[model samples]
Target: MAIFLTGVTGYIGSYLAAELLEQHGESLNLLVRAEDSQEAQRRLWRSLQLHFGFPVFHEHLSARIRIFCGDLTSPRFGLNDEKYDLLVSSTDSVLHCAASLNRKSEKSCLNVNLRGTLEVIQLARRAHDAHGLRRFSEVSTVAVAGQRRNEQVTEDSAIDWDRSDYDPYARTKKFGEHLVRELLPDVPRTIFRPSIVLGDSRRPETTQFDMVRAFVFLGGLPVLPFRPDDCVDIVPVDYVADAIVTLHQSPRPKYEIYHLSSGVNSESFRELTAALAEARGKMKPLFWPELEAPFRAIVERLSRRRDNLGYTASRLEVFLPYLVWNTVFDNTRVVAELRRAPAPFSSYCFSLFRYAKENRFRYPYREWPEIATLPSTARDSEYSESARHVSAGEPAK
Candidate 1:
């Protein structure tokens, strides 16, 4: 009877949750990684607080949200029989937004992206068999295109089994897409592949700062190591989340897969740097494509240190390939469906850059308020008991 959503604790996932709760009428079944219901509530608050105050979040918590305390890597999401059965029987749709984005670690990518997705697929199968599922949506990334350069990739042309991937993250995600199609042949499905999702276009505040830190590092450089005209595909989280929520809920979306990206309209390094320079009243950094090899060596060396510079270099090292790729995913399908285009990164990049720098590359998170009380809805009580019993190795009565 509710929409089963994963990754509610993540950045983009949190936006999706807020959009669904505020703009639509579907109750949400969120699978959170926690030992019990209380911890799950706190985690949800930590992420959802970016969108609203404690009062509104708690109201939604009591009215529409059901917390399923579990892990994606666990079999059946680690939910006991009664709880898992309740989950399947009460769910008519699925939105799999959870994935491990650790591009450096094959082990992390394998366990989370591959194994975790399999568990979500298995749940969709059960729900479909019990009563036909409405839809299944998977939030994928544009990196699945794999080792592209100076090319505009379309939705259908993005995947080629023979092409080499940039990292373990891309490799596993490409295969993960194959798993959904091969295993869930009968379920209605939609795949959303977003490219370089950065800050929100509507606001300067953001909870995720990995990519921002990398951008800041690059911006502070006097002499860069890339071509000035190379276009980098970047889309704001607001547009990506909006496209996903709209298409996922549509009864007959025009296409099964959509590219939530800037596509051909993506700004080049020159344009992006110029905007930032004007905002900060500083001259643009010089670009020298010939220095790429030497710059890469320096970055690799710096990434080994155990200081703040090393931290930034490490983040940049992981994303260096993406920056130099000069490839963009075509957004024709999404633009047609949504009847609007993503705001260019140049329009909002300065605000995000300034905010990240001012905050020391960390989001100022507020602690859970002491006055808040546990949700008292009947379903909340039932799930709370189930979570406690699961954690204590007892059966829920």
Candidate 2:
């Protein structure tokens, strides 16, 4: 039986598609949003090339994939009657990995993550009822445990939605998970929640450079608002893809939620800074708890200047909360199911750093020269001096 997949153009999704094609071969249907089948095929090929960095395997893999150019936000995946019914009858499993990670737009996040998930669930139901679908796997994020700081977030951790300051992306994912559980109570489903997926550990390639790249860029700053011991749970893209594929192939367990995270092996900000510094041959960044207020003030001031620092500062504000996030994601369930543990963040952090630097922290896009290099403005010099003070254990004041 064929496997139906979504988000085949995304970072993790592209890798997952390759893994599935290797395993299933000619029995995978990828749902892509494009103008037509040709564009959809081109996009898929581009994504595979971006991540794999090889053209040899493209022909072999492309021959096996059946691309359906459609949108998940639409009913019947926006396919015509004949195509929709054919899809329902042919597919025996579903892997819904498509989602919007835009943190700034609540409406877009809810529309894609929440409504799109509902559409996937509906498709899963039809596949299950009509075709004896064996599995329904959805990719989710561990961030759904929003704002639950200084705690161990297990697969079954409760989501505290009342928290007013949760990232919109995380909140919508939590709501999407709830909707899945409520609407598909009896389906043989699995929810895999990965934390902070970076580039492939084995390869110096990634489809996107968003969150991880942002953090690496911030490392160049003089002073960062962070705690030395705050853990940042990260897993390599390859490990996450492998774990998800392996779990889907295994016998359906009674417990469905699995955390594809580094878990106990998560790296701290101090360790990450050291690794990045080693990779870049630079001084390790200084972390200061007292710098938070002043850092925000500086960022607000920089935002008004409309320079490289301003752009970076604005982006930094979006991810500042993560620097001090103290929660650790527990991956016991995934560990047991995969019969092994995820590789430690230490082993792969340097590769990611190198990739970010080599690619200029913007994969699949041309690097902007002005934004690439930090300007030597007077404010930047002050920041550098402040960094020196913080590094020497002196107050930033």
Tens digits of per-residue lDDT for model 2 on 177-276? 8888898787778898988787677876666766655666676776667787889887888889998888777666646888888888788888877877
Each prediction's TM-score against the native? Answer: 0.95, 0.85
Prediction RMSDs, each to the true structure: 4.5, 14.3
Question: Where does candidate 1 clash, by residue pair?
Answer: 1-90
**What's the lDDT of the predicted structure labeled candidate 1?**
0.90
Model 2 ranges off by over 4 Å: 51-62, 161-165, 300-311, 364-397
- lDDT string for model 1 (73-174, tens) is 999989999899989998999999999999999999999899999999999999999999999999999999999889999999999999999999999999
Cα RMSD of predicted structure 1: 4.5
Worst 10 residues of 1 by lDDT: 377-386
List of clashing residue pairs for candidate 2? none
Top-lDDT structure, candidate number: 1
